[model samples]
Each structure stands twice: as structure tokens, then as C-alpha cells.
Target chain A: MKRMKKALERVAETGFFLCAAAAVLALALIVVFLVAKGVPAASKIGLWPFISGTVWQPSAEKFGIAPMIAASLLSTLGAAVAGGLIGLACALLLAEVAPRALAGMMRPLIHLLAGIPSVVYGFFGLMAVVPLITQWFGGTGNSLLAVIVILSAMILPTMVSLAETALRAVPAAYREGSLALGATKMQTMLRVTLPAAKSGVLNAFVLSTGRAIGETMAVILVAGNRAALPSSILDPVRPLTANIALELSYASGLHEEALYLTGVVLLLFIVGINIASHLALRGGKGGR
Target chain B: MRKILDALGYILLWLCGALSIAFLAVILIYVLSRGIPGVNWQFLSTVYKPGLGLTGIRQIIWGTLGIAGLTLAIAVPVGVFAAIYMAEYAKRGRVLTAIRFCVESLAGIPSILYGLFGYTFFVMQCAFGFSLLSSALTLAIMVLPVIIRATEEALFTVPVSYREGSLALGAGKLTTLMRVVLPSAVPGILSAIILSMGRVMGETAAVYYTAGTMAKAPQTVFSSTRSLAVHLYLLVKEGLGAGEAFATATVLIVIIVGLNALASWIARRMSQRFTGGAKT
Candidate 1:
């Protein structure tokens, strides 16, 4: 019986280890497959031209991603700035001001916001926000600005939740000390709590930007998907994510490979963002 | 001046909070108001009409469930066992760090990249082709981090004393884990499963390429299928049916909200149980 139990333990341990190893294996597979598919195409196109060339007409065999890259960076910057500020303010309200009951009631709304599928957001954006843009700003309704608005709204929940956690984590002593120094409540929050939670909030902002950068369906629906350089925020542009989703269905040969290369670029951006967010998190821990 | 600025500051905070809430309310109210009117029994129960994009969503619903169910089947056991390994068995060291890093990296990855990987690896390389099996396999990998994190957290909260007591009473480690640890972690695992289901159901880009946008009911796991989210995307993108699009959007929102609420409720209940148990 003891030997049987020992054998069983050994079997369970091996099985559990394989399960854990599966995660590492999955990540490794994703990186390997993406690079293997994407790199040869990158080399053929000459890495610089593929990244910085002017046009992206896949049918004509031209594959440039500069415009898409610019669109992604600009829209994410806009959305992150807009979403991050509003989200930070909302976090402050939730953490420092609102009654516990009200905050509790409000959280589900944020979760709902987060939970709603991007396609639904895209549909809503197309039906509602696009029309408003056309009526007011007078473009094809689908433009970079519409992408920013939709993405900012899409990213709000993530920003608010992360920032709120950071704000709540600020030691109460900081606020108390500021109040004891005769600072007003507003002044204390602004000067004491906000500063103390700065790294965490920054972490939240970086992560939200990553989300904005990665978002695909909603951006595709609203951004008009014109793969070209844009002179203004009102101009329609296709981001890198949109580039892959829009074309990968029918694309074959080198064009398909180019799309995989697009995914590689996107993965690199995500990795960079993750590293930055991780560092920001570590910075918060070090400060504390 | 200081007093006035302070008043403004208070107003700003309230305004921002109100604004965030308003965004949620607007999206919900807008989709429901526009969509609820268009939905009918025929739309919900009958097979979808291809190309027309107007008649029904019975197939889409089934496809969504199939993908989500299969994904959970693939993900949950592997995730739970992985969490068990990390929480109950594994020691602190480089293996733990490597696993943690991979999990975090996976979590941060965008879905479209997963879609790309799914297309290249599952569809082309593995020859699963564009089908339910491909999408499920892709999404299973995508949601592993979520399940592992939640399950590990739940395992951590199972109370060391319970394990100690079982072992002291001569229960073997494997037996204690299976009989004692898992029972308490069910709520967390359930919540995690529900969360991943919601994610898989809502996923569009990753599923779209892996599971081709065929409007017919999926005949088997090997058959190409379009999920509800992807169906909605096609409806809007192709300008197929505006009213139906709205209706589909509403259905998706309703289900997603329900799932999110359920997960949160389970999470709340689990936390309460653990805290209460600790007190006793």
C-alpha cells in the first residue's frame, strides 16, 4: 500500500509538472512560429523597407508599414492620454471620495465596460460615434479620431481598475500626515496620495497604452482602414493590427508572410510595453 | 483662491466618476434600446441565412458555445493542474520565475497576434484548418494564463492549516490535495472558468481566421464556424443587416454582462467563505 501510494505521488507530480511546463511551451511556440513565419519575409523585403517604406499595396507587391505604425502610435497615445487621465480621476474618486457602498455599486459598471466584446464596441462606434463625427467634423466618419474615441472608451475600465488599486495601496499615513500639516483634503490627495501612488498610476497608464496599441476589431471598424499616411487626426488610417486582420483572409504567398511580419512588429511593441509596465510595478514596490 | 480651487477639484473628481459611469450606461442603453426591438423568436431559434445575414442566430450561438466549451475543456484541467503544481508542489526558484514570466507574457499578448499564431500554427502547420477545433485550440492557449492565475490564487487561499490537519491525520499529499484542497478551490476555479468562457465567447479576431466565417451550423468540431462575435463583425463590416447587427450586439452584450456578473459574484462569495473560514 505504501509503495502504491508512492507510485501514485510520482505520477501526479510528473503530470502536474507537465501541465505547468505547457504554459512555457505555449509561449515558446507562439514566439517561434511567429518569428519563423515572419522573419524570412522580413529579410526578403529588406527589414528597413518593410518597416519604413511608403506604400502598402500588397497586390502590387509593395509592403510598407510606416503609416500603420504611425497610426498605431498616435491613436494609442491619444487614447491612453484621454483614457488614462479620466481613469485616474475616476480612480481617485472611487478610492478617496466615494462611500464604500457607492464604490461597490459602481464597480460592476466598469466590469461590464471591460467585458463587452470589442466587436460590440466597434458596432456601437460605427452606428453612433461615426455619425456624430461626420455631422460635426465632416470626414468619412471613419477616421483616426473615431478610433481614438472608441479605443479610449474601450480601455477605460482597465485604466480605472489598475489606477484605483494603486491609489488604494497608498499607505494611509501619508494622507494623515498631510492633513496634520494643515493641508486641505484636496491638497492632500493631490500632493500626498497622488505622488505616493505615482509609479503605480504610471504602470496603469503604460498597461492601458498597451491595450490601446493591441486593440484590433474596434479600431478596424472605425478607422476606415485606409493604409496610408495621414495629415490630420480626421484622416483615415490603418493600424498594424488592422493590417493583419483585414488582409490575412485572402492574402497568400509573400503578402501573407508580410502579415505575419506585421504580427511580429505588434508582438515587439507588446513586449516593450510589458517590460515598461513591469519596471513601473517594480519601481512602485521599491518606493514602498 | 485655495478654497475655490479645492471646490473645483472636488467637482472634477465627481465629474470624472460620473463620466465613466455615463459611458457604461450609454453603451448599454444604446445597444439595448436599438437592439431589443429588432430581436424576435425567429432570430434566436432558427439557423442563420447565409449571405442575407438577417434571419437567425441559432447556429452562431451554438458555434459560440462549442468553441467556448471546447476551449474550457482544453484549458481548465491543464490550468488547474499547473496552478496546483505551482502552488502546492513546486518550490521557489528559476522554474517558478520562468513559468511566471511566460504566464504574464501570454496575458499581455494581443488577441490578433494569437489569431495570427493560430492561423499559422494551428491552421496551416497542424492542419486543423479553419474550424472549431482550430479556434478552440488557439483560445485555450490564450486563456491559460487567466485560468492559472485565478486557480493559483484560489489554491493559495485554501488555508495551510487544512492541509496540515489532513496530513497529520495520515492523509497522503495527493489525497489531501484532491479531497481537501480542490473542494475549497471550486468557487475560484468556477469563476476562472466562467471568465475564460466569457472571453472565448466574445473573441472575434482570433476565432475569425481560425474558424472561417461560414454562416451554416457547424456539423462537427472539424467544420468551419463563425462565432456570434465574428458574425456581428461580418454583419457590420459587410453592411448586411443593420437592425440584425444591433440585435446581435445586444444579445452579445447581455450574455457578456451576465457572465461578468456571475464571475464577480462567485469571486465575492469565495472571498467571503475564505475569510469566514479563517475567522472560525
Candidate 2:
């Protein structure tokens, strides 16, 4: 009976090991499959032209993605800067200024915002944000500015929560020290606690930037799907993600392969961002 | 100058907080005002008739629930066991590092890439076609990292004394983990499941291609179907059914809010139970 029980334990251990390894296997499969399918198309189109070509005429096999690349970069930068500032201020309010009761009430609401679906955000953006932009700023409501506004809103919850956590993680002693040194409450918060928590705040910004870049569906609805470089903020522009989603369905043959190649480009951007976030996190550990 | 700077700081913080709240209020008010009128008994209960113009989202609701259920069913066991291995068994080593890296990478990859992968690997290579099975499989992979992280955190919180006590009683490693550690971690696991359910319900890009946009109810797991989020997207994309689109978006938001509340309630109740019992 003891031997039988031992055998069962061994089996369970092996089973758990396999389960743990599933993540590695899944990641491997995704990278391998995407590269395998996308490489041939990239090779045919030539890497430089595929990435730098301004025209996206699939009929003539012209598949440059310069415009989409520009749109993605510009929108991500705009959203991250806008959202990061607001998120930092909100984090300060929640972590330092607000009473416990009020902060408690607001946290869950923020989480609910985070839970709102991207498609719903898209629909809301089209009906609410787009029209406001059109009425005030002119051009079609669907433009890069609209995409930036929607994405900033979409990423706000993540940014606030992360930055709040970072702020809270600062030791109480830091604030006490500042107070003992005759620093005013606001001055202590801005100087001692904030500086100590700087790395964590930066980490929040980096991760939120990743979220903005990865956002697709909401961007699609508001970005106007125009595969052209925007001369101004109101001009409609497609990001790399929008390009992939808009054409993936009807695409066949080379068109399909090119879309997969777009996926590859987007994947590389996310991977790079993740690496930067990883570095930021590690740097935080060392600073502490 | 110093006083002025402090005043400006306070004003900025208050303005930022109010702005965040304002954004939330706008979305909620707009969606509810436009959508609540359309969400009636017929809209909630009746079947969809695409050609005849009767756009009840009953089938899509079932499709969303079905996908969520199936995806959770597949993800939970694998995720729990994986968390167990990492928390209870694994030590500092290269293998563990690799696993952690993979989990992080999985968490960061965009949902669209998951969609493309599901299309190529599950729908085509595995010959599952555009069906619920394929979509769930893809989502199962996507949510694995979330479940693993949450469960690992829970497991870490389980006091070492409990495991030691079980082992002293001659319970094997597996038995101790199953009886002591897992029971203690149930609340965390439950919350994680609820969170993943919300995500699975709200997801559109990943599910769009894997689960083909068939307007009718799926007869089997293999049958192509449309989730509520996807249905809303299609409605909005086609631009013909404004009322239906708002109603669908409203339904999705309601379900998400419900799930969020349920998760927080469970977490609060569990903590209260622990603290209240400890006093005795």
C-alpha cells in the first residue's frame, strides 16, 4: 500500500510539472508559427520596402507599412504622455491625499473601468468622443486625435492602479523623516516620497505604454483605417494593428501573408517594450 | 513662490482625480442612456432573426457564456497545477527562470497575435475550423498566465506551518497540498476565475476569427458562433443597427460590472471571515 501511494505521488508530481511547462510550450508555438508564415512574405517583399514602403496596395503587391508604423508610434507616444501625467496625479490623490473611505470607494470603480470591453470602448468612442472632436476641431471625428483620446482613457485605469501601488510601497519612514526635517506635507510628498518611489512610477509608465501600443479594436473604430501618413492630428491614420485586423478577413494569398508579417512587426514592438519594462523592474529592485 | 507651488500641486491633483471620474461618468451615462431603452424583455429573451430584423441577442449571450465556461474549464486545472509546481516544488534554477519568462511573455503579447495564432494553428493546422473549441483553446492559453500568477500569490500566502503540520501527520506532499494549501487558496483562485471570466466575455479581437461570426446559436462546441462582444462589433461595423449595437454594448458592460462586484465581494467576505475567526 505504501509503495502504491508513493507511485501515485510521483505521478502527480510529473503531471504538475507538465502543467507548469505548458506556458513555455504555448509561447514557443506562437513565435515559431508566426515567424514561419511571415518570413516568406517578408523575404519576397524585401524587409526594407515592407517596413518603409508608404503605399499599401496589395493588388500590385506593394506592401509598405511606413504610415501604419508612424501612426502607431505617434499615438502611443501621445497617449502615454497624456495618460501618464493624469495617472500620476490621480495616484498621488488616492495614495496621499484622499481619505481612506473615499479611496476605497473609488478603487473598485477604477477597476470597473478597466474591465470595460475594448469593443464597447470603440462603440462609445465613435458615438461620444468622435463627435465631440468633430464638433470642436473639425475634420472627420475619426482621426489620430480620437485614437489618442480613446487609448489614453482605456489605459488610465492601469496607469493609476500601478502608480498607486508604487506610491503606497514607499516606506512610511520616508515621509516621517521629511516631516521631522520641517518639510511641509505637500513638499514632503513631492520631494522625499516621490523621489524614493520614482522607479516604481517609471515602471508603471512603461507598462502602461505597452498597453497603449497593444490596443487594437478601439483604435480601429476611431483611427479611420486610412493607410496614409497623417499630415495633421485630425487626419485619419491606420496603425500596424488596425492594418492587420481590417484586412485579415478578406485577405488571401500574398495579402494574407503580408498581414501575418504585420503581426510579426507588432509582436516585435511588444517584445521590445516588455524588455524595457523588465529592465525597469530589475532596476527598481537594485535601487531598493 | 513655495506657497504658490504647493497650491498648484493640490489643484493639479484634484483636477486629475476629477477628470478620471468624469471620464468614467461620461462612458457610463452615455451607454446606459442610449442602451437601457433597447434592452427589453424581447431583446433579452427572444432568438435572433438576422434577415427578418428581429435582433434579439439571446443566442449571442449563450455563446459568450459557453465560451467563458469552456475556456475556464480548460485553463483552471492547468493553471492551478502549474502554480502548485512553482510555489511548492520549484527552486531557484534555470528551468524556473525560463518558465517565469515564458509566463511574462505570454502576459504581454497582444490579443491580436493570439487571434492570428488561433487562426493558423487551431483553425487550420488542427482542423478545428472556426469554432468555439478553437476560440476557447486560444483564450485558455491567454488566461493561463493570469490564473498562474494569482494562484501562486495565494499559495505563497498559505502559512508554512499548515504544510508542516500535515507532513508531520504523515501526509504526503501531494496530499498536504491538496488538503491544506489548496483549501486556503480557494478565495484567491475563485477571484482569479471571475476575473478571467470577465476578460473572456469582453474579448473581441482574439475571438473574432477563432469563433466565426455565425448569428445563430451553436448546436455543438464545434459549431461556429458569435460572442456578444463580437456581435456588438459586427453590428457597429455594419453601421445599420444603431439601437441594437448600443443594447449589445450595454449588455457586455452589465455582465462585466456584475463579475467585478462578485469578485470584490468574495475577496472582502473571505478577509472578514479570516479576521473574525481569528478573534475567537
Candidate 3:
């Protein structure tokens, strides 16, 4: 009986270990497959030209990602500028000044915002936002401006929640001390509390930017999938993610490898953002 | 002068707060007001109609639920066991720290990367070829971090005293984890799974890449299928049925909101139960 019990225990332990190993295995498979499959294409295309070339014509053998990279950066920065302002303000209201009942209602609103699907957001942009832009500002309406607006809305929840958490983590003493020194309520929040929570708020910005940059399908539907340099916000631009999603189905040989190479660029963007956010989180921890 | 600035500050701050609420309200009202009228028995029950883009969507709903269900089946057991190993069985050391670091990094990865990997490995390399099983596996990988983190947290809160009491009563560690720790942590685990379910249901690009966009029920796990998310994407991208897009959006939003609310409610009730249990 004792031997049988020991055997059962051994089997359980092995099962648990294998399950834990599966996570590490997944991480391994992703990196290896991406690098192995992506690097050859980048090397074949010449890393410099592939990254900095002016056009991205796969059938014509021209594989440039400069425009896609630009669109991604522009949209991310635009969304950050827009979402950051609105989200920080909402965070301040939630963490500092709003009445308890109002804040309570607002909290779930933020959660609901987070829960709403990205495609649904895209559908709204397609039906509502695109029309509004075309009617008001002109152009075909599927442009960088629309992508930024939708991305800003999509990213708002993450920004607000993380920023609020950071704002709340500001030591109570900081706000009280500022108030006692004859500062007004707004002064206490803007000058004292927000400054103290700077790292956390900055972390929120970095993470939200990551989200905006990584978003694909929503942008695809709204951002006119024109693989051209966007001269202005009104001109439609194709980001790297949208580029891959639009073409990978039919791409083969060199064309296919180029898409994987595009994935490599995107992976680098995401990894950089993750590291920055992680460091920012660590910085916040140290400050607290 | 300072008072005027202060008042202006209050106005701006309140506007920002009110702005978020307004956005949420507008999105909900906009989708529902236009969508509810469009929804009917035929729309919800019919299969794909390519020309009109008017899908009955019964098959699409099944694909979403089936894929998400498969994800939970694989992820929950693996996540729970992994959490068990990390929290209870493993000793504190470099291995534990390494695993924790990997988990955190995995959480930071964007979903689209998962799509590329899913397309490359599952669809092309493994020859799953846009099948339900392939996308399910990819989604399971996508949501693993959520499950592991939540399960680990739940296990951490199980109270060391309970472990000690079980061990003293001559139950083995495995038995104690299964019999005692898991029972208490079930509510938290359920919330995590439900939240992940909502996320998987809402996912578009990854599933689009892994599961080919054919909005019909799979005859087998290996057959290709499209989820409601991808269906919505196609509907808009093709300009098929603008009105139907609203209807699909309404259904998607309702399910997602309901799932999230249920998860949060469960979490709240679980916390109350713990507090109440402690008192007793």
C-alpha cells in the first residue's frame, strides 16, 4: 500500500512539472520560430533596405517598410498624446476628487470600456467615426486620424486604470503636506500628488503606447489599407500589422518571408515597449 | 487670480471625468439603438450568406464558444497544475524566479505576435491548416499568463494554516492541494477562466490568422471555421452589411460585458466569503 501511494505521488509531481514546463516551452517555440523564419528574409532583403526602403511591393520585388513604420509611430504617438491627456485627467478624478458614489459608477464604466471588444470598436469607427471624419474634414475618411481616434478610445481604459492605480499609490502625506502649505486642491493634485506618482503614470503611458502600437484588426478595418507614405493625417497609411494581416494569406516564397520579417520588426517594437514598461514599474516600486 | 485658475482646473478635471463616462454611454447606446432592431430569429440562426453578408451566425457563435471552451479545457488544467507546482511544490530558488520572470514577460507580449506564431507554426508547419484545434491551442497559449497569474494568486491566498492542518492529519501534499487548496481557490479560478473566456471570444486577428475565415460549423476539429469577431471584421472590411455589423457588435458587447460583470461579482462574493469565514 505504501509503495502504491509513493508511485501515485511520483506521477502527480511529474504531471505538475510538465505543466509548468509548457509555459517555458511556448516562450522557446515563439522566439526560435520567429527568429529562424524571419531573419533569413531580412538578411536576403538586406537589413538596411528592408527597414529603410521607400516602397513595399512584394510582387514587383520591392520590400520596404519605411511607410508602415512611420504610420505605426505616428498613430501610436497621436494616440498617446490624446489618450494620455484624457486618461490622466480621469485618473485624477477617480483617485483624488470625485465623490464616492460618482467615482464608484465611473470605475465600472472604465471596466466596461476595457471589456468592449476591439472589433466592436472598429465597427463603430467604420460606421460612425469614418463618416464623421469624411463629412467634417474631407478625404476618403479612412486615414491616420481615424486610426488615432479609435486607438485612443481603445487605449483609454488601460491608461486610466494603470494611471489611477499609480495615482492612488502616491503617499497620502505628499498631498496633505501640499494642502497644508496653502496650495489649492488642484495645486495639490497637479503639483504634489501627480509628481510623486510620476513613475507610475509614466508606466501607464508606456503600456498604453504598447497597446496602441500592437493593435491590428481594428486599425485594419478603419485605416485604409493603402500601402503608401501618409503625407498627412488625412492620407491613409498602412501600419506593419495591417500589412501582414492583409497579405499573409496569399503570400508565398520571398513574399511570405518578408511578412515574417515584418513580424520581426513588430516583435522588436513590442519587446522594447515591454522592457521599458517593466523598468518603469520597477522604478515606481523603488520610489514607493 | 489663483481662485480663477483653481476654478478652471476644477472645470477641466470634471470635464475629463465626464468625458470618459460620455464615451462609454455613447458607444453602448449607439450600438444597441441601431443593432437591436436588426437582430431577429433568422439573423441569429442562419449560416453564412456571402453575397449579402447577412450571416445567420449560429455556426459562428458555436465556433467562438467551442474554441474558447477548448482553450479553457487545456489552459485551466495546465494553469492550475503549474500554479500548484510553483506555489506549493517548488522550493524558493533561481528556478522559481526564472519561471516568474518568464511569466511576466509572456504577459507583456501583444496578441498579434501570437497570431504570426500561430499562423507559422500551427497553420503552416504543423499542417493544422486553419482548423479549430489550431486556433484553440493558440488562444490557450495567448491566455496562459492570465490563468497562471490568477491561479497562483488564488493558491497564495489559501492560507498556510490549512496546509499545515491537512499535513498534520496525515494527508499527502498532493492530496491536500487537490482536496483542500483547490476547493477554496475554485471561485478565484473560475473568475479567471471566465475573464479569459470573454477575452478569447472578443479576439479577432489571432483567430483570423489561425482559423481561416469561413463562417460555417466545422465538421471536425480539423475543419476551418470563422469566429464572430472575424465575421464582424469581414463584414465591415467588405462593406457587406453595415446594419448587420451593428447587430453583431451588440451581441459581442453584451456577451463580453456580461462575462466581465459575472467574473467581478464572483470575485467580490468570494472575498466576502473569505472575510465571513475568517470571522467564524
1 or 2: which has the higher lDDT? 1
Chain B TM-scores of the candidates: 0.97, 0.96, 0.95
Count clashing residue pairs in model 3.
Answer: 1
Q: How would you encode candidate 2's per-residue C-alpha lDDT over A1-288 as one tens digit per residue?
A: 999999999999889999999989999999999999999899889889999999999998899999999999999999999988898898999999999899888877777789899999999999888999999999898999999999998889999999999999999999998999998889999988888888888889888888888888888988998999899999998998889888888999888999999999999999889888878888988987
State what share of the real interface contacts each candidate retains.
Answer: 0.90, 0.81, 0.72
Flag regions of model 1 displaced more than 4 Å. Answer: B50-54, B277-280
Ranking by DockQ: 1, 2, 3
Q: Model 1 clash pairs?
A: none
RMSD of each: 1.4, 1.5, 1.9
lDDT of 1: 0.92
Worst 10 residues of 3 chain B by lDDT: B271-280
Candidate of highest DockQ: 1
**How would you encode candidate 3's per-residue C-alpha lDDT over B123-176 as one tens digit per residue?**
989999998988989999888989999998888878889889999999987889
Pick by lDDT: 2 or 3, better one: 2
Candidate 2 wrong stretches, greater than 4 Å: B273-280
Off by over 4 Å in 3: B50-54, B277-280
Note the DockQ of each predicted structure. 0.90, 0.85, 0.75
lDDT of residue B233 for candidate 2: 88
